[model samples]
Target: MSAKVMPDAKGRQVWIAAISKKSGYSEELVASVLEKHGIRPKVTAAVPQRLMVTSLSFTGKKLGATPPSDIDFGPKPMGPGLWAVTSQRNFRGKTSILNIIRWCLTGRQYIADVMTSWFTAVTLRFTLDDREFEVRLSNASEGTGELLKHARGNEFQLASFSNHVEFEAAMSDFFMEELGLQKIENHIEKDGKGIDQPHGWVWLFTAMWVEPRPSALFGVQMPGAMSARMMQMYLGFPWVNTTNEIKAAQSRFRVKAAQSHLVSSGIRATTEGRIASLAAQRADLQAKFADVSPNTARLKLAEASQRFVNADADLRAFVAKKQVAEDDFESAKMAYAEARRSSQAAKESAAAGYVFRAIRPVCCPSCDEVITEEAAESHLRDHTCVVCKTPDRKGDDEEDTERTLLLAENEAKEQLDAQTTRVRLITSQINEARLARAKASEQCATAEAEIADMTTVEENTVRIQILDAQIAELRNLNQAETEAEDGDSKVLAAAEVITKEMYEVEQGRVLKRVSDLTKEYAVTFGIENLQSVSIDGGVRMKLIKNGQPTFFSKCTDGEKARLKVAATLAMLKVSEDEGVGRHPGLLLIDSPGDNAMVSVDYENLVSGISTLSEELKTVQIILSAVSGPVILSHVPKARRIEAVGDDYLW
Candidate 1:
C-alpha cells in the first residue's frame, strides 16, 4: 500500500509509512496519546493486528507551517539503526532518517545492534550488556511472516513493550552499576543493618511510551528462577530466615484487621436501629391518618347520598312553618293601618286650630294698644309710660300697684342715702388735707434750719486770693513805671497799664458769658433761675427756672451732641495732647450751617460752637448743607452730601 510522508517542495504530500505498536493500549488510547503529543494517527487494525497509522503529510497540514513532520523509514535489516527525517523544515535541507537515528544512538550502537531484528509485529528489543529482552508490540504483518517465523514469534496476546524494555534496563543498571536498584540497596545498608527490615521492594521504571498511557498495566517478569525460589523462601519455612520480630508484626496486623471488622459490625447495628425507629414512626403517622375522619375517605357516590338526605329534610320543614306566620302578619298589618289614619286626622285638626288663633294681634295692658305678644311682655314688666314720665299704672291690679309703690319708696330712700354718703366723703377729705398741711409745715421748718447753717466763706476766700495776686502784679508794674524820668516813660507806663486793663477786662467779660449761658440754659431746660455750680456733682449746675427745679438740665438735642463730642475730646486729650490740632489754633467751620436749623438760635449756636472749638484748640468744625437759599446763608464752604432718594442724606 502507498504511504504518505512529509510535504514536498511545493508543499504537496509524498509517500510515507506510519507504524504504531499496541503497547497494551487500545486503538482509542493510542490515538489519544498521539494527539496529546501533536500527532493524530488513525487506527488501521485492532484485535490480533493492532496498529495506528497517520501520514506525515497529513499531520503537517494539521500543524500548519513551521517545523516539518518527521517520517519513519523503517529499522536497519542487520544493525541497530532508526529511520527518521533530519530535514524538519519546508525549504531545501538534508532529508534522511539515518541522521536522526545516528544522533540518538551515539556510542550505544554496539548494544542496540543485538536488539534490531525484523519481525511480523512491532517488537521493541532492549539489551542490557549481554542480556537481551524482547517485547511483542503487536501481531505480525503479512510481509513480515517469514521474518517472524525465523524470530520464533507466537500468537498475539496483550503485551506491553514499554514495560519490558524499562524493566530490562532497570535490572541491568541496578545490578551492573549504582545508578538504579543498587542505589536503593546502598541506602538501606547505610541506615544500619539492624534497622527494621523493609516489608517489600518497589521498582519504578521510566520508558518512552509509558507516560502517554499511565493507566495501562505494566507486566514485570522477575526472572522465573529467582522468583520461584523467593516465593518458596517467603511461604515455605518462613521462619528460617525471617526474624521473630517480623512474625510478631504479622500477628499484630492480623489482630488489627479483626478489630476493625468488629467496629464495622457495631456501626452497622446502630444504623439498623435508627432505620427501625424511623419505620415505626412512619407507621404511626399512617394509622393517625386513618382515624382523622371517616368521611375523609368517602367517594363521590357516598357524598351524593348525604346531600340528597339533607335537601329533603330542609324542604319539608320550610313548607310546614311558612303558612301560619304569613296569616298572622296580614291581620296585624290591617289594624296598624287603621290606627295610623285616625292619629293623622287628629294632628290636622290641632294644626287648623293653631292657624286661626294666630291671625289676631294681642293688646298691651299698659298702653291699651294692639301689639305682638313679645312686645306686650316687655311693656308689662317695665311698667313705664313711653310717651310721658308718669308711671304706667294701668296694668297694676292690686298686686302690681303695691309692687310699684314699694319700688318708688325704695328709689327715694336710695337718693337720701347717696346725699348722706357725699357729706361723709367731703368731711373725710377736709380732715386729710389739714393733716397733710401740718406735716408740710414741719418739713419746711426743718429745711429752713438746714439752709441757715450753710455759708459761702470758703468759696469767697479762694476768689479773693486770685484777685489779690492780679492787683499785686499791677502795683509792681506801676512802681516800675513811676521810676522812669520822661513823659515817654509815662506813655510806656500808660501802655503797660492799658494792656493790664485789657486783660482784666477780658476776665470780666467771662461774667457776661456766664450770664448769657445761664439764660440760655434756663429757657432750654424750663427752669426759674441758675443756682450755684457744684464741682462735687459731676460739674453740675443746679437751676430753678419758671418755678421748676432741675440739675444739669441743659439736655436739648444740640447740647447733648456737643456734650458727647466734648467728652470724646476730653478722653483723647487725657491720652494724647499734642497731635495736629494742638492748643491756640483757629476753628474752621465747613458744614456747620446745614444742622443750624435744628438749633434754637442757629447763628448764635454756630458762634458758640466756633468759640468752644477755638477754646479747645485741638477741635475743628466740618459742616455740610443741602440747601443754600434760606437760613444759614452766610456760612461759606459748606460741603453737601448729595441727596439720593427722598429725604435721604447720603
Candidate 2:
C-alpha cells in the first residue's frame, strides 16, 4: 500500500477521522455508515480522583442455625494504609466486612446469601479527592439507601433511593460524576449475536478488590475484549480508550455487514433461480412450437388468419352499403307516393272545372222556367247565361285553368313514374348489397373455424411471451439488490479493518509498560524463576515460568492469585506514575494465603503488599486472611481487625 493510503499516526485519531483522512470519503459519509451499523464512538473518562475509606459500620441479625445470632460492626475510623481483616480460621466474617463495604459503595451485593440474610443495615463513609461523603443503607436487603455529603459540620443528602435498582443507579451516577468515570462501552457476542453491553462504576470498581477465587485476567470473567477494555481503562493510556471504542465499533460493523450480506445473498439467489426457471420455460415452449409445426402448415395458418381479417372488414363495409341502399329505397317510395297523390288531386280538380263549365243554367233559378230556342241558340252562340242574359265572362280563364290543371297532372305523372323507377333501382341495389354481406360473413366464419383449430399451440405461444417478460423483470430486481452493498457496505468494511489495525498498533506501547511492571511485581510476590512477562494488546498475559511459556489460566491457583495481585499493583503503580490513569488508589484482597502451599510464598505476598503500600503512601490496601505469623509480622497491630481465637471478626 502507498503511504497515502496507509496514513501514519492513524491510532491517534478517531475512527472516522483516521479512515476518512486518505480513504477518499467525507467525514459525514463515514459517520453515516457508522450510525447505520449502530457504531457510536465512546468518550474516555477523565483522570480519576483518589478514593479512601475513612470509616464504616453495619448491624446484622444472623439467620436460623447460624453462629453469632446478632452482630454489629463499629463506626470504624481508617485511613490510607494496609488494613487487615483476619481471623484464626475461615468463615470468620472477614469476607463479610469487605462485601458490606463493597455493597455500600456499588449497591451490588456480592456477599454470600446466608451472610446477606443476616444483614439488616449498613453504613459506610468514604471520600473522593478528600471530599467527604457517606452511604447509609437503612434497609440493606431492599437496597434502600441515602448518599450524603459532609461540609463544614453538616450532612447534606446527595441522593435517596427506595430499591436496589435505584440504589445502584444512584451510587453509580454519584461515583461516576465525582470520580470522573465514564461507562466502558463494548460489543460482545452473546448467544451467537453481537450486542452492546456498557460497564458502569460498579464494573470499574472491580479493580479495587480481589476475591479468593482464581482470576484469569483483570476485572470480572467477561468473554472477549472486555478484560482488555478494563485494562486499557484503568491503565489510562493516552489514546488507548479511543482505540477501545474503535474496536467495539468495528466489531459491530462487521456483524451488521455479515448479517446484511447473508440476507442479500439469499434473496439474490432466489431471484436468479426464479429468473432461470422462467427463461427455461420460455425456451422449452419456443422449441416445442418450432418442432410441432411444419413451415407449410404455418404458412396455411397465416394465410387463413389474413383472409379472416380481410373478410371481416369487407363484411362491415357491405353492411354499411346495404343500410344506405335500404334508406334510399324508402326515400324513393315516399317520393313516389307523394307524387301520385298530387297527380290524383290535379285530375279531380280539372274534372270538376269542366263539369261546372258544361252544366250551364237550363232555367231561371228563381222561377224554374225553360229558355226559348232562339235565346238558347243565341246564348250558346254568344256564350252567355240564358236566364240572366249576361255575356260569358269565363272564356279564357276557364280554358287557361283547364290547361294549367292538365299540364300539372302531366308533370305530376312524370314525376311519379320517375320516383317508381328510382324505387326499383334502389331495391335492386339493396338486394345486391345484402347478398355481398352474406357471402363475406360466410367466408369470415370459415376462416375463423380454420384458425380455431390451432388454439392449443397459440395458447403456449402467448404463455411463453408472458414468461419472457417476467424473467426480464426478475433479472432487474436481482441486479438492483446485488448492487446495493457496493455503496455502503464496501466503504464500511474497509473502514472496519483499518480501525482494528489502528487499535492493535496503538495498544502496543501501553501493553508493553504494563507487561514490564507486571513481571517486576510478580518477582517481588515470589514467582520463582520469572524470566519475562508479556501482556498483549488483548490483555492476555504470558509468562515464562521455569523456562516454559505459561498463560494466566494455565497457572496454579496460588500462582494465579499472586499474579493477579501483582498485575493489580503493577497497574496501580503505572497509573500513579503516569498521572493519567483512572484507578482509585485502593486495593482489596480476600484470602490471599488460602492456596499458598508454603509459608514463605504467603510471606512474600504479604511482604510485597507491605512494601508497595509504604512506598505508594497515598494508596490503600485492605486484605482478609486466616491469621498467621506471615500476616502479623508485616502489618502492624493498629491496622489489624482480628478475631479472638476462632471467633468471627464481625
Candidate 3:
C-alpha cells in the first residue's frame, strides 16, 4: 500500500466544506477513514454532443375531397422564423393542430382514440436540419395504425405496419434519428428493486415542447428528476449512462447491506442465546481446568508452562500497580500538609484587615502623639484628628465580624484534618494490598511449576478448550461483520462525493450558460432586475432578479410568462452558443397568452419571440395563441394563420 494516496482522475472523495462543518470531521480524518476502507470515486470527463430539429408539419386526407387538400408549410422554407396558429374561439382545433404535429414528432395525440377516429392516412412532413422525411399513420380508432416513412425525393420506404407497437417504434425511431438521440439503457428502481431499460421518447419529448397548464409552475410536463435528466441529455451531457449507473450501484449496495443486516442480526441473536445455553458447558470446562486426574491429558508442556507463568505475572503486575498507588497516596499526604498550611495562612489574612479596623491606636503612629481613651472614643466619629487637628472621617467597625472569620477558619481546619486522615488510611490499605498481591504471586508461581509437570489432559479439559474456541470464533465473526458494515458506510460516503464533484465540474457549465442567456433574453423581453434564470432539477424556474432567486409563484402573471419563455428560449440559445446542445432549435409553444398577462408584457413576449426568431438563425418557433392584437400585430399576416370566419386551424 502506498503511504501517499492519490485522488482518482474520474472522481474521488475530496474535502467538502459543508459536510466537514456539519459533521465536525477534520478533512484529514475523513480522508484517512475513507482511504482505510478503499472508498474512492473515479472521475470521468463528459464529452460534448449536439442535435436540433429544423421543422415539423403534417397533413391527412380531408372529408368531401376525393383527393387530399394541402396545408402547405413548405410554400417556402421559412428560415429561423415564427409561425403562429391563432384562434380566439374555444375548441376551434388550434390545440389539436399543434397536438397533431406533436403526435408525429412524439407518439401521443390529443385523445388518441378520438383523433384517429376523425382522420386516417395522416402524413407528417418535417425537416430535421437538412433531411426532409414524412411519416403517415393510418387505421386509427381500432387501437391499430399503419406507419410509413419516406424522404421528399424518396418513396415511402419502411413497410406498412398495422400494430401500435410497430407504429410507436417507427415514430420513436423518426424523432431519435432527427435529434441524434441514442437508445441508452437506464436503471430504474421500483419497490426496492432495480431494473434497466432503454430511455424512451416520452422523456425526450418533455424537453422539446411544453404546454400551458393553469396550475403548473414548470414549463416541462415530466417529473422533476426526469426533466433534469432530459435537459442534461439535450445539453450534451450523458445523463442516462452515468446517473443510471450511480443509481444502480447505490440501490445494489443498499439491498445487499439490508440483507447483510438481517443475517447479522440472526447470527447475533443465535450467539446471545447460545451464550445463555452454553453457561453449563463453560462451567464444566472450568471444573476440568481445576481438576487433577491421572487420566487427564495435559496440554503441551511448553505452552502450559508459559500460560501458568503468565498467570503469576498478572499477580505481579497487580503488586506493582499497588506500589505505584501507595506512592501517589504519600504524595497526596504531602499535599494535604501543604493545604493545611495554606488554610492557616488564609485564616490569618482574613482577620488582618478586620483587626486593624477593630483595634484602635491609643497614640498616633505618624507623629508619636499620645491618645487617651476619651480621645480615642472622640476619634471614632470625629471630623478631625485630636493630635494634629487634621480633617478625617472614621467609623466604628461591625461587631462579631472576627467571630465569623474564626468560624470559617475552624471549618477549613476540620476539612484539612479529615483529608489528612483519609490519606493516612489509604496508605495503610495500600500496604495490606501489596502483601495480599505478593502472596497471590507466590501461589501462582507454585501452580505454574506444577502445571509445567503435567503431560496429559482429561476429557473434561478438552470440552473446556472446545468451548473457549467456539466463543472466540463467534467474536471473530461479529468483528468481521462490523468491518463489512463500516465498508458499506464508506462506499455511500464516496458515492456522495462522486455526485457532488460531477455537478461541480460538469453540470455547473450547463447551469452557468442558462443563467447568462436567460438574463440576456429577459433583458430583451424588457424584464428589468431579472439577472438570470435557474431551473433546479427542472422542478422550478427561479428568476434571479438583482442576484436573488425569485420563485415563479412570487412573480406577476406577465412576469411569469416572460420568465418561462425566457428560460425555454435561453436554453436553446445557450445550446447554440456552445455548439453542443442536442436541441435542433425548433420550439412548439402552446398558448403563450394563457396567463392573461399584462398588456405590455404580453406584447413584449410576442415581440421578444419575433426578435429571437430573427437573431437565432438556427431556431424555428411554432407558436399557438388566442386572437389578440398584441400577437397578431407582432406576427406578420402572411406568416400567421387566423381562425376568423370558417378559416379555423383544424
Task: List the candidates' TM-scores in order.
Answer: 0.14, 0.64, 0.54
Expressed as tens digits, the lDDT of each residue in 558-643 for candidate 3 is 66656666776787776666555566566777786676665676677789889988877677777788877877788988777668
TM-score for predicted model 3 compared with the true structure: 0.54
Q: 17 in model 2: Cα distance from truth in Å?
A: 4.7
Compare the candidates by TM-score and give the number of the best one.
Answer: 2
After superposition, the stretches of candidate 2 with alpha carbons farther than 4 Å from their true spots are 1-17, 21-24, 35-45, 65-68, 178-194, 269-507
What do the candidate models score in CA lDDT, each in turn? 0.31, 0.72, 0.59
- Identify the superior model by TM-score, candidate 1 or candidate 3: 3
Candidate 2 TM-score, C-alpha based: 0.64
Candidate that would win on lDDT: 2
* Alpha-carbon deviation at 63 in model 3, angstroms: 12
Candidate 2 or 1, higher TM-score: 2
Query: What lDDT tens digits, residue by residue, belong to model 1 across residues 242-281?
Result: 2122222333333443454465566556655655665565
